[model samples]
Target: MKIYPFLKNLSLVYVLALVVSCVGDPIEQPIGKFESGVLIINEGSFGANDGDIHHYDPISGDLQPNVFESANARPFAGLIQQVRVVDGLAYIVANTGKVEIVQAADFRSVGAVNDSKLKIPRDLQVIGQKLFISDYGPYDENWNNTESFVAVVNGLQGGAVHKQIPVPSRPEGMALIGSELWAACASGSQLVVINPATEEVARTVEVSAGSPHFFVQFGANWYVYAMDAERVYFHRINHSAYSISETISIPLANAIYNGNFTMGTNGDVYIITTSGASARVAKVSIETGVVLDAEYFVGSNFYGLGFDSSSNTLYVGDHAGWQGNGQVWKVGPSGSLIDSFQAGRGPSGFLFR
Candidate 1:
């Protein structure tokens, strides 16, 4: 068929458009300076109001100090306890009874939940639009956390306190399994389960090991770790029954009660243990329920533990006695020391993107 010059040009343009559409648009580069890096939560001196956030670029090996203050033009006013990134925002729970909402990508302040009911807020768990915060409620005359509760915020973005559900003393780490919200009561031997739909305590399971502080989920089961003076106990709870199915105890001379624990990519549990002044990472096999390595990664003053499943790297934080800048040790998958980088004061937790 004979074709005019204009018609031939139109056919070429249409083919070019079709090829471009099939390939799709180019992948956009991340614009935020703090995006695509590890965020280090610095507890900074308690009550000193020096709490800060540090950003470390794993690919570039560049550490950006005080990214929170740099982005907001003001220092974080409370002791940063933990950070949970949901959607595109970071909910920073602080010991100062406040949860600061910031842009996860840029570390910019967006909103905050400063309710009086958040007495010594320890951890945060977001279920849909609700934000559940575990708090070690106000202390009594003897300086005991006798009135611990979970403060529920109605909205995800710095909403007002919807209710405060009372629970055992010293509630710490929390998790949402199925439909129930399980909270670890660090001062007592109980794992309180709350029905998020009703925002009330559904039941409490007594953990004989006591001081259940953290949890790790592997496959269809959930494991919680507790510590006593002589041993560290790992209890596997049945997801449907909400009861402990198995208990694994690992003897230890001196075990720190910090809730620094994480699950490796292989479904093994890694916890921080102390030997005199040095800190060690203990690995526990999920299948064997035995101590795989009592000293997986050893270092000094290891205060926080986080595992990056993407790279199979373990990030251990060294508080340096709460002195100047802290350090984060990067351990390889084979339990070998890879590298260490300086972070903010009292590097307590990590958030990897």
Candidate 2:
């Protein structure tokens, strides 16, 4: 299929074809043409111009590295922070100052958005047809954060920001519960509730005196991870009144606050923490706010954790310093390694198709 690339001064004139190349390495289950696999996002060294994406097939044990450059003939400006794959498109957010949009099915460059409002974009969330980007706005001459806002952009229109909605400083992870959007401010110490209809701050939930960073929604309850305090703040929201019903705090042990986590099928949270040498994954219960498994899964350089509900398999991203390349492990619930494959540097995030 043909896809268009993002250009600054020119229109969408450059077209590229989407291609998939199989690796030479052989393994147990080879992925078919349309089979599901894993996509690993590598946050390359800052300013090193090495950020790239890797694709792995568990059945085939095939690993494809730097699929972005392979498909588009150009590299991402490095420092790739996160990638969100939704609506058949992959949105790659890099500290290099833009969101690169690509066709998810074939990894072809579709378009991009690098508006002035996107200075230091951190995270992204898609609600319906709109895309919300959390930006840590530029700093002043004194090295103080000027202001942080969420740039609202049209997912269908592309190439420009639709509007800038002011929020707390250093906005990070964002969650959408019904019509309300909750954004965590890493530097503001609160969770800012935004009413998308009005594009304004509805209210703020004081998570900590320090900062509330990442967030995940499980059923009717919302969990916000406060790294500065080593606590996970849970809240019950009142949608009608646009307020929080109740808030509970759950403290964690030996939390290093530098990894990614995901929710299991049974509503439990699997959080990863890297220690002096080894890494561990713990399961936190959503109902009781208790640690179900203090050491559910353990490894070295376990940078990312994800749960696949279809096969009940857990995929762990191991960036064990393999010369800028990484490894992905398919582990059982009991922490037993089932399979392992190669990937890119710092495999910090995953997307299963």
- TM-score leader: 1
Cα lDDT tens digits, model 1, 1-353, are: 88999999999999999999978978777667766878888888765768888888888898889888898998888899888888888999998889999998888888899877678999999998899999999989999999999999988788688899999999988999888999999887799999999998888898987579888777777888788877777888876887898987777535666667777876687778887788888887767767889899888898888788888999998889877778899999889999998888888778787
In model 1, what lDDT does residue 145 have?
A: 93
Badly placed stretches (over 4 Å) of model 1 are 1-31
lDDT of 2 at 148: 85
Q: In order, what is each prediction's RMSD in angstroms?
A: 3.1, 12.5
Error of 2 at 132 (Å): 1.7
Question: Cα miss at 69, model 2 (Å)?
Answer: 1.4
Against the true structure, what is each candidate's TM-score?
Answer: 0.90, 0.82
Model 2 lDDT at residue 3? 45
For model 2, which pairs clash?
Answer: 29-59, 29-60, 30-59, 30-60
